[model samples]
Target chain A: MMLIDTLAQGLLLGGLYALFAAGLSLVFGIIRLVNLAHGDLIILGAYLILTVTTITGLHPFVAVLLAASLMFGLGWLLQTHLLNRVLGADILPPLLVTFGLSVVIQNGLLSGFTADSRKLAAGAIEAQSVDLAVVTLGVMPLLTFASAVAVIFALNRLFYRTALGRAFRATSDDAVTAELMGIGPQRIFAGATGIALAVATIAALYLGTRANFDPSIGPARLLYAFEAVIIGGLGSLWGTLGGGIVIGMAQALGASVNPERQILSGHVAFVVVLLLRPRGLFPRASD
Target chain B: MTPSRPLGLIAAFAALAVLYALPAIAPRALVQDLFGVLTLLVLALNWNTLAGFAGLVSVGQQAFVGIGAYAMFAAIILMDLNPLVGVLIGGLAAAAFALPMAFFAFRLNGAYFAIGTWVVADIARLGISQWKALGGGTGTSLPKGTAKDMAFVDRIKAALDVSSAAAADALTYWLMLTLAVAMLVAGHVFLRSRMGLGLQAIRDNETAARSVGVDPVRLKALVFLLTAFGTGLCGALAFIQITRVTPDAAFSVIDWTAFVIFITVIGGIGTLPGPIVGAVIFYALQRLLADYGTIYLIVLGCLGIAVMLFARRGLWGVFTGRTGIDLLPLTHRPPKSAAPQPQASRRTA
Candidate 1:
């Protein structure tokens, strides 16, 4: 029963990890550019939500809706105006530029929030729980997991079933060829980033409610997201969820053995997965 | 032949002499400031060697820096070794650690490789933080006895006519100055060597270089280890100056990797003189704007982004492009008279 409960908790925790990584995987898939600032952008979304909730006295979910739309526009403008210029043969420019952006976002938050950790007021939902046949699960974790599944499903449907998804696939396959075929790669990239940021806003909602966050936490979050993305395999959304679960389980199991080993266990799992499957568990067939 | 080579050498030596004599006349604070600058210069050179020449952009260099600091602390606290020797131990430990990390990181390409290094560094930090003997996450300070008994502290105190603390500062500054000069000379010499040519070829195109019998993996691994060694030395020197070792401070990506990358990119990548120019500019900026706190970092990030987007070649690149001067030439250019002779002979033959 104890082991089953631990596994259940781990799988639920993986849901949150998947949320953090979904935006990262989405952006990487569309543009072949890894934004080092992806984690910072998530935190930015969280802060935006916090601000909305504070100003409007609305529910956090409502605040997320507002933050998501705002972030989408911000993402679109960022890609169109800035990221597009740096995208090319050399990978250094995009990576460094994003790193610079990461620094900027982090410090900007620091200046505004003064490095104090903040959490969202989620009311009764924060302490609610659900009972299964063998174990109990927190309502927040269950919601996070459910949301992760919905987000992934929606993203997959959009990619395979929607015209915009077709554009993304075509653009990802070959930007120049897609452009020649009347698909504007620039616009596609902007849309992709916008969508990614919208997903980031959802991740932020859970992040703010589930745990405390500060300006400095973004990079550490980025580490976990990157690990999950890699473990799932690059460019594979489902793989990302699997990767997150693996890490979550590892951390949970490590904590069962020794509390101090929790984080280290997740990192060790990442390295082990990397060593065993360099391309990840479900690397994109195209890649 | 370029007329600048001989003049450059003379100027370099003269600058070294000036730096050597600086502690004698300069205030203690200024010496400490220059020490910080020189430490950063060493780090920039190491980063430049890896990213600029070898095409390996690692944001996890703090892994080595942190390891080096902890290694030094262990030597001082547990092994009861001289701090000077601990510096060397720290460097070797970092290099040894790099071997395994490179095996994992090298399997990754481009941006994945960058993040892979960061993950490794984070893992190291977490692991190191568990060792309660080293004060865990809270960290530890070098014992007062160790500081008082550091190598050459007495000699420096007598020579500088100063107290023990001032003498220690002077000693550290001189050690950093020597290491900085050595790194510059060594970097220049390495880049002019055959391996440097292979590394550059690999950077341009890995598969093409491999076809030409240049082992990209071997060259990259070698450079990675070498840079780790130098970075470890810098980390040890930095911690020695502070006489304290904390996991957070030692493994700080912002201080170690981000600033170094910014300096390298903003000065110029893929050039010998670029890091030096970049380091000077960075030190100047820090001195000027450090009082503003987070604003200074924001300005740095903004400047880094601006430079990457608008001036990719950086300040040194612009300077060399406009003036057509190569003070430290890594590429050999035959004389005008000698250049046509080979082509003419080949045509006639």
Candidate 2:
């Protein structure tokens, strides 16, 4: 029963990890370039939402709706201006550029908000819990999990069932071919990054509300998101969800034994998964 | 045919002499500042060999530094050995650690490899934090007067007639200078060697290189171990001056990797003199903006991004491309005897 309870809680935590990973998966799926600044961007979104809430005296949830749109614009501009210039055969430029962005964002946040950890207040929902079967779960965690599922479903729909999704896939498969077929690969790439950031904003909502976050923590968060994306494989969205669950379960289990080892265990799980599945659990057939 | 070769040799000797005599003539603060620059230059050189030449862009170099540091601390605290000996042990231990690290990280390709290395570094930090004997997470400081008793700190103190602290600083400063010079010379020689040519070939086209009998994995792994050795040695030397050992301080990604990466990127990625140029500029920028809080890094980050966007080969590359001046050339030059005199402009005749 105790084991079951731990697994249940782990599943909920996995939702948050999945949320963190979804945007990262989206950008890599289309562009095949991993954005190292991803974690910092999510934190930036959280800060944006927090700023809106404090100024407007709005609920954190409502504030995020505004933050998401702004983040989408920010993402669009970032891709159009900065990342687009670095895309090519040599992977060094993209990697280094994103790395520079990560440092810039962290320091920007540090200067603006200081290194203090901040959290969003969500009122009664903070204490709310739901009992399912033999396990009791937090209402917030349930909401986070449901949102993750919805985000994945929506993204899947956008990917396969929408024209933009086709463009993304077309561009992902071959940029030159897609360009010859009358698709603007650069525009498609910008759109993909913009959507990824909007999704990151959603992740930011859960992140800010769930725990305290500061500027320096971005790299570690980036690590977790990256682990999920890798362990899940490159092109599969649902696989990323599974990867997140695996990491979450590992951390929860480690925490059950020794709290200090919680984060380390998640990293260990990543290593083990990679050792077992080098291309990840569900690598894209083409990749 | 070019004057660069002679000029490079002259500049190299002059720089070495100046660096060697700085402690004697220059202020102690200058020695300390140059020490910092030299150490960063060493890190940048090691990173350059990995990312620029081998095409292995690893963000987890801090792992080697941290591992090297913890091993050094353990040697000093547990075995009661000299810090200089501990530094050698640090380098060896780092190389040993790199084998398992390479085994895991080598499985990843390109961007995944970078992430893989970063994850491994995190694991190393966490594992080191679990080491209770070394004070675990909170970490421990060296014994009182340990820096003063280091290999040559006393002898230098007597000769230079300076305080124990200044003597200690001088010892580290001299060691850092020697290490940086060694890396520069060795990097130049290695890049001009057959193995280095093979490594560059592998980077340019792995499949073609494989067809020609170049083993990418073996060569890259060797470079990884070599860089790990250099990084570890630098780390141990750094902590010797710092006199404290903490997991966070030792494994700090920004201090160990990010700034070094920035330095390399700003100077030039593949070339030997790039790190030196970058390190000098970096040290100048740091000194100029020393008053600002976190602004220094923010500026560097922006500059790094700008450099990537506009000048992919960095400042040194641009200089070399425009002026055809390579102070430290990595490319092959044919012997004068092999050149055809038929089309040559013979000024002597």
Candidate 3:
């Protein structure tokens, strides 16, 4: 029973990891750019929410909505103005640019928010839990897990069922061909980044509500999300969830054995997965 | 071609003389600052070799740095080795660690490869932090007598007529100076060699180079091992100067990798004098903006971005472009009298 409870909790934690990785996977899938500033962007989303809630005195959820739309616009502008300019045959520029962006965001946040850890106030919902027959799960964790599933589902539907999704797929396959087909790859990329940021905002909502966060925490979060993305296979949404769960379980199990081993164990699992399957569990066939 | 031998030799000797005499004329704090600058110069050179020359942009150089530091500590604390020897041991240990890391990391290409190194580095940090003998996550310091008993430390103290701490500082400065000079000389020589030519060829066009008989993997591995060894030595020297070692400090990406990348990029990567120029500018900035904290980092980030986007060739590149001066002369050019030749003919020549 205790083992089940632990596993269940880990699964829920995986949900949050999945949320963190979803946007990363989406951007990488559409455009082969890996945003090294991804973790910082997530933190930026959280801080945006914090600022919104503090000023407007709105509920955290409502603040998240406002923050998400703001982030979407920021993401659109960033991609259109900055990232688009750097995109090309050379992979180094995007990586270096994103790394620089990461630094800028981190230090910017540090200057703005200081180093003090901050968390969103969810009131009674923070304390609420559902008692399953085998285990008790926190309401927040459950919501986070459900949201992750819903996000993946929505992303999947968008990819397969929508014209924008077709544009994304067309652009991913061949940018020149997509352009010739009258699909503006630039605008598509900007839209994709905006959506990715929206997803990142959702991830931020859980991250800020579930735990204390500061500016420096972004890189570590990036590491975890990267691990998940790698383990699940790059560009696969469902696989990302699986990857997150694997890491989450490893951390939970490591914690059960020894508290200090929790984080290390997740990294170990990632390395192990990498060694055994260099291409990850579900590499895109096209790739 | 002009026989540049005498001029080069005289310049080298003059530089050495100035470095050797810096302790006498410069303030103690200035010597310490130079020590930091020299250490960074070594890191930038090694990183430039790997990323700039070999076309392998690794963001996880902290893996080697952390390992080198921890190995030095382990050597001193566990093996009872002299701290001087521990520095060498630290380097060897880092080189050893690089092999397995390369085996895995080399499998991935581009961005995956970059993050692969970071993941391995993160794992290395976590693993090192678990060793209780080394103060676990908190980290450990050098033994009480180790710093005082460092080889040549006593001689330095007596000769310099300074306190033991200051003597230690001077010794560290001299060591770093020697290392930095050695790295520059070695890097210059290597880039001028046949192997270096092959490495550059591979960097330019991997498939074409492979077709022409250059083994890309072998060349990359050699560069990787060499840089790791050098980076390890720098890490050991840096931590020794601090006289304290922590996993976090040892494995700091910002200090070891990010700043080094910025320096290399801003100074003009893939050139001998570029890192030198970059390191100087970086040192100047650090000294000027040390008080600003995050604002300083933000500025650095902005500068790095600007360099990456607008000035990819960096400061040295811009200077070289306008002046047509090749300071280190890594490239060979035929006299103007010679007619233009085909690529094949040029290679044969």
Candidate 4:
């Protein structure tokens, strides 16, 4: 019964990881550029939601809609103005630029937020939980998991059933050919980044509501997202969810055994996965 | 790039002389600052070799540094070895660690390699923190009088006729200087060699390079091991001055890797003298704006991004383009009379 409860908790936590990774995977899949600032941008989104909630005294759930739009604009601007110029055959420029952006966002948030851990108050919802037959789960975690699923499902629909998704797939497959067909790859990239950041905003809402967050936590979160993406395979969204669950389960189990090993166990799991299957469990991309 | 002029070589040795003798006449403060600058230069050079020439943009260099520092601490505190030997052991230990690291990270190409290395570094930091003998998470320091008792402190004290502390400072500064100069010269020689040509070829087009008998994996792994040794040596030597060893400080990606990456990018990624120019500018920036909290890093990050977007070649590349003069040119040129056009001999180079 105890082990069952731990697995349930792990599975719930994996939902948040999936949310964290969904935007990252989407952006990487489309642009072929891994934004190192993905985690920091999520942190920035949380800060935006916090500021909006504080200034307007609106519920965080309501504030998040405005924050997500704001993040989408910022992401669009960032891609068009900065990231687009650096994208090229040489991978160093994009990687380094994103890394620099990560540092800048982290420190910029530090100056603004002053390193204090902040959380969003959700009233009674914060204390609410549901008792399943096997275990009791927090309402927030359950909601977060549901959001993750919805976000992934929506992204899947957007990828397959929409003209923008066709543009994205065409551009990702061969930018030159896409451009020959009158689709601007840069515009597609900007759209992808904007959507990714909007998804990140959803992740940020859950992040701020669930636990205390500060500027310095971004890099660790980035590492976790990277691990999730890698473990799930590069282009597989469902595989990313599986990767997140693997990490969350390993972490929960490790914490049950020894508190210090929680994070290490997740990393160890990543290495183990890599050792067994270098291409990840469900590799959708041939590359 | 212009042909290397003998006069530039003469000027370089002259500059090296001034740098070495500065500890004797200049204020101790300046020497210490230069020591710090030189530390960054060494790290930037090693990083350039990986990211610039070999196309291995590893973000987990702090792993080698942290491992080196910890190994040095263990050597001194637990094994009771001399600090100098510990520094050597630190480099060797880091290189040994790199062997396994290469085995793992080499599986990932391009940007994935960068994140792969960062993960390995985090694992190293966590693993090292569990060592109870080395003070674990909180970290430990060198014993009292450890610096004073280091080899040649007595000799440096007698020669310089300075206090033991200053002598110790001079000794460490001299070791770091030697390492820095050695790396610069060795880097030049290595990059100019056939193997260096092969490495660059791999970077430019791995398929073509392999088609032409260049072994990408072997060369990349070798570069990885060598850079790890260099980084580890720098780490061990750096901690000797810091006199402390904590997992947080030793494994600080921001201080060790991020800063080094910025220095490399903002200078010139593939150029030898780029890090030197970048370090000078970085040192100046630090001195000017360090008073403002977090602003210095903000500026660095901004500059790095700006360089990436607008000036991929960086300041050194811009300088070389404008002047047509490379202080240490990597290109080989035949005599002007021997060729109708300069582009003729550029293929092999």
Estimate, for each residue in A154-203, the C-alpha lDDT of model 2 and write its tens digit.
99999999898999999999899999999998899889999999999999
Instruction: Note the residue pairs that clash in candidate 4.
Output: none
- Provide the TM-score of chain B versus the true chain B for each model in turn: 0.94, 0.95, 0.92, 0.95
Better by DockQ, candidate 4 or 3: 4
Each model's TM-score? 0.97, 0.97, 0.96, 0.97
lDDT of 1: 0.89
Residue A151, candidate 1: C-alpha displacement in angstroms: 0.5
Model 1: per-residue Cα lDDT over B258-326, one tens digit each:
988888888888777788888888888898898998888898899889989988878887777766666
Worst 10 residues of 4 chain B by lDDT: B340-349
Judge candidate 3 at residue B295 and give its lDDT.
Answer: 80
Query: In model 2, which runs have C-alpha deviations exceeding 4 angstroms?
Result: B335-349
Q: Judged by lDDT against the true structure, how good is candidate 3?
A: 0.88
Give the interface RMSD of each candidate: 0.7, 0.6, 0.9, 0.6
Off by over 4 Å in 4: B1-4, B334-349
User: What's the lDDT for residue B164 in model 2?
Assistant: 92
Classify candidate 3 by CAPRI docking class.
medium
The best candidate by DockQ is 2
Error of 3 at A285 (Å): 4.6
lDDT of 1 by residue, A1-287 (tens): 88988888889888988999998999889899889998899999999999999999999988899999999999999999999999998989999999999999999999998899999889999999988778989999999999999999999999999999999999998999999999999999999999999998999999999999999888877888898999999889999999888988898988988898988999999999999998999999445
List where candidate 1 sits over 4 angstroms from the true fold: B1-11, B334-338, B341-349
Select the stronger candidate by lDDT from 1 and 3. 1
